[model samples]
Target: MPAEKINNSNQAVAHSFAFVACVTCAVSTAHAQSSVNLYGEIDAGLAYFSNIGGHASYQATSGLVDGSFWGLQGTEDLGNGNKAIFRLESGFSTTTGESLDDHPHYVGLANDSFGTLTLGHQYDLIHDYFAPFTLTGGAGGTAFAHPFDNDNANNTYLASNSVKYVSPTLSGFSAAALYAFSNDAGQFANNRLYNFAANYQNGPFTAGAAYLHANGRGNTAGGAFEPVLLPGANRDVFNASVAKQNTYATGASYVIGDLTLAAAWSRSTFSGVTDADSGAVEPSAGFSNYEVSGVYQLMPSLVLAAMYTYTKGSSAHWHQGGVQADYVFSKRADVYLEAVYQSASSGAPAIINSADPSSSRNQLLIGTGLRAHF
Candidate 1:
């Protein structure tokens, strides 16, 4: 063969090899930019309740300070400041291996400049924004949640068949909204919800406000609250003929040195209640909760916190107090002791964590637990 022909053939092969190398490099770079993470927390403890249906009991509990759960979350860079994100989280009873369902399971798209949009079962705006200041929110856990979790600051209910939007934080301000579809053909208002929230945070101060409205409680599978999300018999809290429900909440927290002080208020109303076997019989019943809480860093690794909540309803009232001592063993684990005391009047039963209602008007609970995050 001619030398010139050989040279031409070699050039053709070299060009093809170069193209393959460039393609492989591009694919590798894109793969490296995407990330998937498995993260979760587990909290287990032994608790003693001075009164549960008038009987004191000792039991092993899970998720005292934080719910025991695992999750898979991931993001893929789509370039141009846009990305795709998804999360699937589940809760479980650490002692009995019972799986808790109706958690957040969503996939969405996000952008640095635009925002985020997600679909599936997800949290309402109140849980995202205003709950942080409350004890039952991410800060204090279940032991400090409001009575019956009526305000939903502790995420007692999750919205299904929903769409959520979250705006990027601007100057320490962020906002979010959620809408859940009832999926009841021809019954548009049967168990639908609309929620919105906003938050602002600065050096030492943070504030949040949120609103939520649900139509036709107990009329759908899981619009706002349902028995599936709770233990047996605990469904009595919302098991009634309620035409509508609304909640408004606001809170503010200030940090000074190692101490943080916070206050929150919420008003919840159930309208058009019927003469059912459970729930209020009035046309409308309302509940208002006032809370004041504080967290102090006793040392670098030890912390002390307390909260006092006064709740008043149309027919009853309650006073609740909570205190906790936490010791950090490391960044991923900790141990804590917490207690809650409650007193109710006007024939209202003292209920803790939606467990059995106390036969009397007073109830007390103490628990010690270990928590780890990964």
Candidate 2:
């Protein structure tokens, strides 16, 4: 145990400690390369509905134009041009402080060159591709959806237990598709959906088309929509379990200077609709909607927009119009004012977003709101 022996032992121990520290630092750096982000929006507003039960009423509203929700999104770099990604979003009412039953949650794998594949509760191709050109899908928000949201352009329902694929853009063109399982052990078709879409964007012009088919519309155990749970008045409009629902849509948009113009068309058909109570098949029905919208930038912080839609059925027709003004307080916050009017030539009551039906065949609604994003 001489001094030289002690010094040699100390140097060996120092080397071992240095090695451990280097390894720890390397591991921490690798972990830090992967990142997660939290983002969301909360929109609240005041709304006035005219002709609701023959009386005008005012109430606090949430997500009138855009849904209010909070979400977490993450991406992990797996190296070799691949990554893992995920998102979870929840919707809530600002007035009642209640949760919205339908929201989007998803996890996925992506490749910079190959494409992206995701699974969970999510929107189909219609909502992603063609809906963007429609007022509801664009900036018009929740209240701008077509009658009944029959075409799902406003994301009225999310396809659960779903698998989706989105291809990378090629020469300004991209495509996406999705399929949802019924999740019923013995009934593969009990509640299933499949959809596909393609889009193209070149400079200031954009266009897209989508198609969707679903079976067992009201089978809660396997389906996303519970038509029977709708309000009594609007319930009958979709109460029956539709054996099959087919929807098709196409949309186009163009930007000229400070003005943007858009147009869209959608058709929906239901076959073998059955009474939820009696389980009796009812007659088939269908509807078609045509819409046009325009948005103009009054200034860098102010914008104005207008939209009109015409819906037609075998015996029903509706004419709807909307106008909106928005002013930006900041990049993450804004205030908006909107007015909507609808005229119907049908015995069915006029309803918007599950609110009470108009006492007559015509209805008008006005709203002012604020939205913040983070």
Candidate 3:
């Protein structure tokens, strides 16, 4: 009778194990149906400007090249090789929690295998790549940006009500297109912008081309800064008009061992009534900009970079140079020091000094900061 009882107990234990395995498999299958992720970065720094138009100041800032923000991204797997995806991102000041560009929230969606489409506040293609490769070092923050950031053309990165599409990679090549709406129903064309870009990467060589067009009103000016006052203009001729503008740029980069090299060129043209009335008497006035930069890794945790940029405006011209060094404390944190100097020619009014009535001037900046990611 005792041996019979032992055999019955063993059979019951085996049956219990089989039941647990079945339940585990079911839970795993359910989890595979959905996925969600959380991600973000926090970057802040202390900076000082020696001569901000004859004034010196100090402050703390965020998002030097990449803004600081937290976001959620997720996807739901529908059977038959299809999936639905979504993302919500927010940008805020690390020092004061103030939103950047008056926007605190952004959202978008896409398909799994097909190309992705997203609508919200986002960066144009030039800001996506060229800005970083140029004097701004791609960081729109106060530290690495170009002198007066005139070359940035007021984009500082990101636009409201932007819709973007990204194509899948084909042999290390991809393309993207974007459109931004002014969000005003009656003034459909006001502040509207469109951009397209193509890129290719193979081995240690990479190249890209991009185009941008903008039309409408408000502060969506085509240049880094508006032009200076003209001889015969009633209003502050410095203000850009609700006009049409077109821009194009191309760039390439190469990497060899510890050194990387890059170069880019861009042109912008402005037209319409405002431009004409403000002394752009001809069909339009434009500017051409060129940049070259390089980075060298001195150590596993240290990098040094330098860049030179030239802007030849149809109405003005300027030259700028910058140098920087960064030390990596870890993969997620780093400290950097940088300096930039800019000089204008007397041919026309200095573009960087539009606020002042000056034909030739020089400006300098120095800063140090820290950046972290999670």
* Strongest candidate by TM-score: 2
lDDT of 2 by residue, 1-374 (tens): 99999999999999999999999998888778677788888889899999888999898988888778888888888889999999999888877889985678999999979999999999878889988898888878777778777788888788888999999999999999899988878888887888999999999999999999888867756564555422122664557777788999999999999999999999988887788878877778777999999999999999999999998865788888999999999999999999888888869667775356788998888999999999
lDDT of 1 by residue, 108-166 (tens): 99998889999998988878888888877755788788887778888877888789999
Model 2 — which ten-residue stretch has the worst lDDT?
224-233
What TM-score number comes out for model 3?
0.75
Q: Please write out the lDDT profile of model 3 over residues 32-143, one tens digit for every residue.
A: 8878788888877765554443565565756544567887878777676556667777778888888755222344555545677777766677766565455454432343
**Candidate 2: segments with Cα more than 4 A from true spot:** 1-28, 224-233
Which has the greatest lDDT? Answer: 2
- Candidate that beats the other on TM-score, 2 or 3, i.e. the better one: 2
For model 1, what is the alpha-carbon lDDT of residue 164? 95
Report, for every candidate in turn, its global Cα lDDT versus the true structure. 0.84, 0.84, 0.64
TM-score of candidate 2 versus the correct structure, residues matched by position: 0.92
How do all models score by TM-score?
0.90, 0.92, 0.75
lDDT of 1 at 247: 91
